[model samples]
Target chain A: MRFYESKTAPASKGDLTPMIDMTFQLIAFFMLLVNFTDAEQDQRVRLPESILAVPPDEPYEERLTIQLASKDVIIFAGSEFSSLDQLSRALLVEKQILEAREKKVSDTTIIIRADRESKTGKVQEIIQACQTLEFLKFALRGKQAEVRVRSPSN
Target chain B: MRIRHAGREDTTELQMTPMIDIVFQLLVFFVMTFRIALPEGDFSIQMPSASASATLEPQTSPTLQVRLKARADGELTSITLDGTSMSDFTDLQQRIRRIVRDSAGPGESGSDREVEIDCDYHLKYDYVIQAITAISGYVDPETRTPHKLIERIRFAPLQK
Candidate 1:
């Protein structure tokens, strides 16, 4: 096998402008990607509204939101979990992070934004997962004062 | 940042290799995590919570238990407010309002009667929300505020 040497070829400068541009673009992309983590939530679930439901004014010290959708789908922080074990395991990791940060595990509130049509059992299951992790604080999400039609009269 | 070739070479070239490698890694990370369309959950919503064994304040007021029974297909079969069965959500709403009125009668300080929602495991959440709506009266759309029948509401713990 003959290997051609480029020693005789004219020394040329490959433009680094594109690489720099692409890198900047990527950095910007990931920066925006992470800044907007809320974009990954499943939108199919319609939230229930309550007159008493108030929007939180204070930022969470540390928070995790769980979205429960129809057909038994449980999504945590943008990843889907099919079983309670998976959900618990993932929650344990979050618990450890809080622990390492010198924060109390129970202080980490798990926000549940379940679809209005989702099974209560499923929502309960997610709560149980948080409870198992010793994270007792919870925030259940509902829209504020939504006008909904009453159930059909029999 | 560019490095100068030591003594003889006059050319100054930008250090592209390392920067390019790092950029690719970042691009890959962002691409892997990019989700094209996830629209909702933009604004946060807050809900009131109650513990299973939480005792009622102003103990004279009864804790209303709204039980929802469902068929195998997830259709709501019955909604009983404290064992009195009702046909639909409106009936449940009326009964709940009446109970609230009685508990916190006029010419008296409103009673903070607690409500516990106990739902069948297989029931669709639509009905549960409906029951919640029934118990939680809507705002007069024009007024944007409606008095709640029961101020303290919580989920009933499953019977183990």
Candidate 2:
């Protein structure tokens, strides 16, 4: 009888309000800090560092991002092209799309995210491909370095 | 009557299971999608097509050419600014500063000064960027402000 009485007693419930409040705070914190602009950054290319590589005051009106993963591979719009001929064809399609929208092809900035180890000639070739398409503005992207590159007088 | 009061109080207890489940799911979703991005910047340059460049009239100031020599293994060997050999990128920056200071009088901007980067075929792209960084500008260590050196930058024809 004693065992039955002890087993039938109501269980204790501690306060859950504080835990719920803390979890809600954590959720709010994470929601405020989440970013979705990292889609353009690829893991294959490690950009060269430059102290003078400061973000532009105003973002370009229209921009196309092209990444060079290796000497033989170029990534544009998540598609890989091995040769300049293929890349040129892709760029032509993009130009046609821009023209269809009544947009000036020259106004679109080409952002080159070439690997630090890639060949310079390959980058120039990429530029030549864009040039052939009448895209004039080129923005060479680089990782920001914190080191001080002071002037000679200093 | 006492048992009825106790049952009424039990019925008033909050239902927290569903709310907690949804909150945890949201937290997990955010945690899974969180990404830390490194700050990046650009060096903007405008280059016209070869045919267009040929038709354009020559400027009053000559385009200063900086040549980068590289080894078979794709390492930078030497830097030359307008046919004058430079020991390193720092030296190149000094020479450019002197030229800009002398050419541009008081309150004149360096926009008219142009620089052309001529890189070897097999050179690593990083060295070319280093050259561009040195030619474009320098950051003041004291104020962390970037001072512009040359605004106009163009790449030379690719060397075979």
Candidate 3:
């Protein structure tokens, strides 16, 4: 019997060090640069799109995030508040926290990240609630650059 | 330990089983949880509070109200600028520019102007953004300047 009639040379071991090193680098990249999204923004909510949207300028100084999930459902910091009144109370607590750090809550640039499906007036009511609480400065958030939208005046 | 024959294929090898397993697991986790879209903009608007009413100089600068009336399906049916119905966004822009030109100086464009957006109860946010883009003048590619038809924009009381 010719069990090992036509035999090739024994194979050398392949080095996995390079593969492991490259994999680790990729993992590190995702870990460091991946979006660690804020608690105020729920990824499930589809945001509205706008070509005019741009990041807020500093010296508007302290900022607060208020998410309007629906007309009744709102969230700020970490707690979900059902009513605008409740949301403002939570905002008040946050203002105190900021004031403890010598920051002015009044100077805060409030970002309203309402869902695309939510009514505009729901967002407006949240603004009214914030306004009633004296947190008057506001900003509306939208998904930026969906189109290279040509503005009428641009 | 058994000695290998010289020039025979050195059997010693890097065991990649564990490393591949861990790497694949990490890849799966990030791939599933990765968020593609990011919130990149905070278009600023301000409301004049009763306490800080004096600093806004409302008397010096008239507030232009942009009214957006929407249908039950949350689409805008009409856009009116201070009771005058605008034909389209272009007309809206022209009227706003004229408003700014009348009050604003060469260097003081829209400094003294204020804009109030009166949105209906059921309007979708898309139309609001469209309205904002229309009234909030475009960026001047010429001088790389952001031309402001009005710097101060506030939402008016929501009408049912």
Candidate 4:
């Protein structure tokens, strides 16, 4: 007696479509999270201290940084202004320019980095100048003081 | 029937290219808006802490202001009261006591006389505390009585 055998064809395809879709999603997630620093910025000022201080952990875009050095007030995006009046004008111009180009200005903020040893009068002047230009929001930069431990000699 | 069988095994593909592009765009937007804040220095003063301290009432006019400058030799070289220079610490102490005493009434509290102390940044911590102690009621070592003269001492940073 002879036995009859049946032959079956194997599945031809393994799908890579799901993997490609997942890879694309991952790429998108990282792309949305990356923050880019503006090139025309300057941040070289000593900050004041407090009893409770935390390091800043924000992304760097959409900020206008103002750096106050020993003698001059430097605008990060534009030219340095020697006086508060000049800085005010430059701020106004920049604000208008940004609004005109972007058609929106709600998210922009100003950052003031003044040296810790600088006078309060100067810092107030800068604040007043910014207020006049309608740049009401500001972030004051400051460093966390280092803690020291005392060892007792018995 | 033949056409229906041919369509049964058809596979549909979803393109993720546009979704990926939009996600990258949002990431770039957030990254561009990130701000790194620099430190601000001036007027960041470490005030000496006191548990028994009370806040002062607002002054209608400028109170008596005393400016104390500490020299490199660890001595208070100059003392100015309300823009007028005083010759010695004794004189400064006397002036403060007189102002506080004159301001207080018989039944009124001594908190009205506010003394503002403008200290130099380079001054030693001990010197600052000493100045504060002096401005407030000084305790006579011999009599051991705390004279309730000056009511409050305000610490102001020196203006550059």
Instruction: Judging by lDDT against the true structure, name the best candidate.
Output: 2
Candidate 3 or 2, higher TM-score: 2
Give model 4's TM-score for chain A to 2 decimal places: 0.58
DockQ of 3: 0.49
Chain B TM-scores of the candidates: 0.56, 0.84, 0.72, 0.52
TM, every model: 0.62, 0.88, 0.77, 0.37
In order of TM-score, best first, we have 2, 3, 1, 4
What docking grade applies to model 2?
medium
**In candidate 2, what are the lDDT values of residues B1-160, reduced to their tens digit?**
4455545444477788999999999999989987777889999886889888889889899989999999988999999999999999999999998888734333445557789999998899899889998888777676666677887899998887
lDDT of 2 by residue, A1-154 (tens): 3454456667889788999999999899888888776588888899999997878899888889999986558999879989989899899999999999999998999999999999999999999989989999999999999975467786
User: How would you order the candidates by lDDT, starting with the best?
Assistant: 2, 3, 1, 4
Local accuracy of candidate 4 as per-residue lDDT tens digits, B14-55: 766686677566656655665654332211122222321335
lDDT at A34, model 1: 67
Q: Report backbone clashes per prediction.
A: 0, 0, 0, 20
Q: Candidate 3 has which clashing residue pairs, if any?
A: none
lDDT of candidates 1 onward, in order: 0.69, 0.87, 0.75, 0.55
Which portions of model 3 show Cα errors greater than 4 Å?
A1-12, A37-39, A70-72, A146-154, B1-29, B102-111, B139-146
In candidate 1, position B71 carries an lDDT of 75
Task: Write down the DockQ of candidate 2.
Answer: 0.67
TM-score, candidate number 4: 0.37
